[model samples]
Every structure is written in C-alpha cells, then in structure tokens.
Target: MKFQVIRLRTLLLSAALIAALFVFCLLGNRAILTVSGQLQQHGTPLILIDPGHGGEDGGTQSADGILEKDINLQLSKKIEALLHARGLQTQMTRGEDTLIYDAGCKRMREKKVSDIKNRMAMIEAAPDCIFLSIHQNYFSDTACCGTQVFYSPNNEKSALLADAIQKAVITAVQPENQRVIKPSGKEIYLLYHAQVPAVMVECGFLSNPEEAAKLTDEDYQNKIAAAIGDGVCNYLNNKQS
Candidate 1:
C-alpha cells in the first residue's frame, strides 16, 4: 500500500511538472508573437529624397537666373542634414548636378525618360520607404507664391504625410501661407504611380520675385529644411502612436 501511494505521488508530480512547462511555453510563444507583430507593423522606413530636375532639365528658372535644379538640390541637401541630425535614415536620388539615366541614351528626351524610370525603379525596389520629392513651382501670373504639397493617390497614408508637411511649413516659416495639401494627379509621374507613400513639395514659386529671392537665401532654405524635417518626424511619431 505504501509503495502504491509513493507511485501515485510521483505520477502526480510528473503531471504537474509537465503542465507547468506547457503553460510556460505557451506564454513565451505569445510574447514572441506579440513582439514580432509589433515590429512588422511599425518597422522603421527609409526616407527617399528626390531633388527634381537635373542636368539639361533645369526645371523652372527665376527671372534672375536662379535655376530650379540648384535650389531643389540645395533644399534637399539641407533637409537630408536635418533629418540625419534627428537620427533618421535618408537617401537622395541625385546628390550632384547630374541626371541619373541609363547608358546609351543620346537624346535629351531619352535621358529625361530614363532618369524618371530609374527613380521610379528605386522607389519600387525599397521594401519599405517614404518618398519626398523636392521641386519649385511656377506660374505665368508670377503672383502665386506659396508652398504646396501633393500626395500620392496609391497610398492612404500619403495624405496624412502631406498634411503634416504643409502644416509644419506653414506654422514654422510661412505663417501667412494658406495653401492646403492636394492629391497628386497623372501629371506628376512619380507620385501618380508610386506604390508607397509619396509626396512632392513645391517649396515655393520661382516665378514670384519675392519668393524666389527668399528661396535663394541660405537662412530661408534652412528654415524650410527644418520645417520639412519636423513634418517627417511628426508623421513617423504619430504613426507609431
């Protein structure tokens, strides 16, 4: 009888130990799955900064000969620096005064097309990223001079990002600016077809003498860059929240 009691106690203890281990493993797996899900949902994304117009395509030009390409590159570089200072990863489409086109492209038209195609390929190749294209605006009236943001229609988050940038710029620099964010149309080749979140910032109108002068100023460029960087950071923080 004593032997029988001892065997039963041993069996009960073994079963208890097995049950405890099973519960522990189940909880551990749940914790692991939770962490994995969080990482997948809120992964850090690459910031792809594209400076519009380069090489032969000078884009819009100010009356005083301020090339749009130069201003775009300047602002893009400043913005990249600001973002980097805040510990964000960024990549520029063109860091120099050259076009990114395929070899063997002899004509201007071919080069422009190739350059755009290559940029699009870069956007698509990034597994997870945000596209920010910098460009200057122009109008025949010459009086239209305020920053505008256009967002991609392909991604739902694009509108939020655009709004954040618009508001940030308005609040930080152009307090009188009343321009709102707009949805990018077919005319914008990159934003129109981008599968990921994309936005084009028409920093200001080069046609307007006042705005053109400001755009060329180093201090104003820094302000614009800081505002843009803040906008991007705000968007990312809100997304994580």
Candidate 2:
C-alpha cells in the first residue's frame, strides 16, 4: 500500500509539471503574437513604391534588349510582396507596364510630364509616407556597374533612407560595391520635387553587359527586392526605437 501511494504521488507531480509547461508555452506564444500585431498596427510607415518608366518611355535598354521599365516593375512587385509579408502597408504608383499620365495628355513629352506629376501627387497624398522609386542606371561607359541610391534634398530623412538602402544592398549581395548615396538634383524630377522622405534606387547599370545579365535574372531581382525590403524595415524599426 505504501509503494502504491508513492507511485501515485510521483504520477501527480509529473502531470502538474506537464500542465505548467503547457500553460507557459501558450502564454509565450500569445505574447509574441501580441507584440507582432502591435508593430504592424502602429510601427510601420506607409511606403509609396514607384517603378520608374513605362510604356513609351522604356527608360534604358540592355544589349540583349531587356527593358529597364520591365525590370523596375518586376523588382517593385517583389518588394511589395516582401513588405506585405512583413505586415507593412504599401502603395504602388503603377502596378502594370503602363504610364500613370492624365488622359488629356497627348504628346509623348506631355504624357511623361503628366505621369511624373501624378506620381508626385500620390507621394504628397500619403501622410507620413516614404517614397521609394526603383530604376536602372545607364552610362556611356559599360564598365560602370553596381547599385547606387539617390535621396531627395527636400527632407533630411531622405539621406538616412538612402544610406540604409545603399548599405543594405551592398551588404546583402554586392559586397564589392563601393558606391555611395547621392542627393537628387533637378535632373530627377520626381525626387527633386518630392516633399516627403524619398529615395531612388538605381538598381544596376544596364549598360554593363555582366550587370545587365544579372539585372534581367528573376532570382537576382528577388534578392535585390529582399535587400531593399530589409533596408526599409530596418530604417523604420530604428526610427521607432
């Protein structure tokens, strides 16, 4: 009888420990979920993604005929997906390979101006938003390669955003990249006029054959998007902290 009582006490103690462990795990998971939800609800900033040129304006072209507009849209879509997965809010100036110009615009130049104006309007419409424009770079020399970032001069925070993206891309993929972020001049219409924090990512030089090949690759574009996404998230988190 004494042995049986001892065994029964041991069984009771084991069951109690298991019950306590289950409760602890349940509470821990709930705490994690709550923190995640809070960050999604309050910590994230609205990101306005503008994929550079489209339609008649194909921007730059690779030696193999890959269009910069197409690559920009593709990479922007990937970045949008990454941001959404992280529970962040995002809006795109153009989702398809079409210009966001006013219907009244007729000539090519007029349409181009209208498209840029409309994109700027979108950036201004959002409250406390971050503007990220994706584009491909080109130079007369094919030797010029690697990603570069440009920031709007209107806002001080734009430089910080640009630095984050430039560093993130180099650290994540192009370890050899030595290019630094530059301030946008009047030449870049959108960035020059943007009132909110804005940065344009010149993803790579389409003029360079080797870089062009990598830019056209779907896998490489995804990696670029992921790095940009990480940079945006890191910037926002740091700002919040």
Candidate 3:
C-alpha cells in the first residue's frame, strides 16, 4: 500500500506540472498576439523634424547677415505645415528661435555628451518617429549651389526617402538639381545613430550669391516646401502600396 501511494503521488505531481506548463504557454501566446496587433496599429509612423542651430548658435550666415538658424526654423515650420495639410502628424525639436536643449554646466566633453543624451532621450520617447533635419550649407566654392538630400547611413529606407525628396526637388522646384541624394558619412550625430529612417536636406548653399538671394525669397521658399511636400507624399503613397 505504501508503494502504491508513492506511485499515485508521482502521477499527481506530473499532471500538476503539465497543467502549469499549459497555462504558461497559453498566457505567453496571448501576450505575443496582443503585442503584434498593437505594432500593426501604431505603424502609421511619425516624422520628427529637427531644425539645426538656434539662439546662441546662428549657424552659417549670408552676405545680407541672414542667419542659417532662422532659415532652418522657417523651412522646418513650412515643412510641418505642409505635412499637416496632408493629414500627417509631425513633432519639432525646437519650435522657437532660442534654446531647447540644456548644454550642461561644465565645458568638458561630458557636457556635450549630456546634451546629446538629453536629445537622444527626447528622440527615444518617440519610437515611431522618423527624423528630418533641415539646414543650409556654406561652401568656399561659390559655384556650388542647389538642394542636396543626405540619408542616414544606418537605415537603408532613408536612402529611398532621400531619393524621393531629391527627385521631387529636381522635378518640381529646380530642374537642374544635379547634386543627387547621397548617404551621410560623419556629419550628423542623430542620423548616425538612428535606427529609424532619417535624412538631412541642405536647401541651398549660402556661398553662392544668386542662391543666397533665392534662399531669402519668400516665393522660392514656398516652392522648396512644395517640393518637399510632394516628395513626402510620394514616399508615403509608395510605402502603402
């Protein structure tokens, strides 16, 4: 009778173990399915637009004393408006002319690191957002002028987005935009590290006298914005298809 009891206990223990395993598997599967469905729902994608330089940092300047930071902010606002018009949502890193990020107290490299970390944290909070940085380029060579789009090296999808934007600029705004879309190498810190699709657009070169004049023109700015809007529209359409 003692041997019989031991065998019966062993059978009961085995059944309990099997039951626990079945419950665990059921819960795990339900969790996985729920997560997968959430991902599909949130895949609409948000665009994080970062306008380069602000306040103390004036970025590149033009002959008329126009600051690159101001131009960048203006362009970014235009882009945001254009995107909204198409029912797309956007978030700007700096909505004003002054500082948005704290550069820290110390002047050491750690301060810079802290600044970057702060920026990264802001970015990380918006995981579904892709990135677009707006800036104007300056070259010692005055002959170099035209819009150039650069994609993040870390993301292959960024290359396609850059290409579409470049095409839009060439077809809609400047028929002679021979600059071409290229991959960013060592220029932007955010683009270098982003796993999301990201690109930096250099609207025009301030060094070129004529281009500088055009960059400051209100009508010309609208044209540039329209081109970018068209580019983004095309990209989204293609993605959906």
Give each model a TM-score.
0.83, 0.82, 0.78
lDDT of each: 0.90, 0.89, 0.79
Q: Candidate 2 at residue 158, lDDT?
A: 93
Global Cα lDDT for candidate 1: 0.90
* Predictions: Cα RMSD each: 9.1, 13.9, 6.3
Candidate 1 Cα deviation (angstroms), residue 164: 0.3
Q: Give RMSD (Å) of candidate 3 vs. truth.
A: 6.3
lDDT of 1 by residue, 25-87 (tens): 875544322211221222457788999999889999999999999999999999999887877
Q: What TM-score does model 1 achieve against the real structure?
A: 0.83
User: Which parts of model 3 are misplaced by more than 4 Å?
Assistant: 1-43, 103-116
Task: Indicate whether candidate 2 or candidate 3 has the larger lDDT.
Answer: 2
Ranking by lDDT, best first? Answer: 1, 2, 3
Better of 1 and 3 by lDDT: 1
Q: Which of the numbered candidates is closest to the native, going by highest lDDT?
A: 1
* Tens-digit lDDT string for candidate 3 (1-241): 9999999999999999999999878755443222112321243466778888776678898877888989899988999999878776677888998645464545545444555555566566666566788899999998999999999897778988888899999998889778888887765787788777888899998888899889888899999988987887788788778
- 121 Cα displacement, candidate 1 (Å): 0.7
Q: Residue 42 lDDT in model 3? A: 40
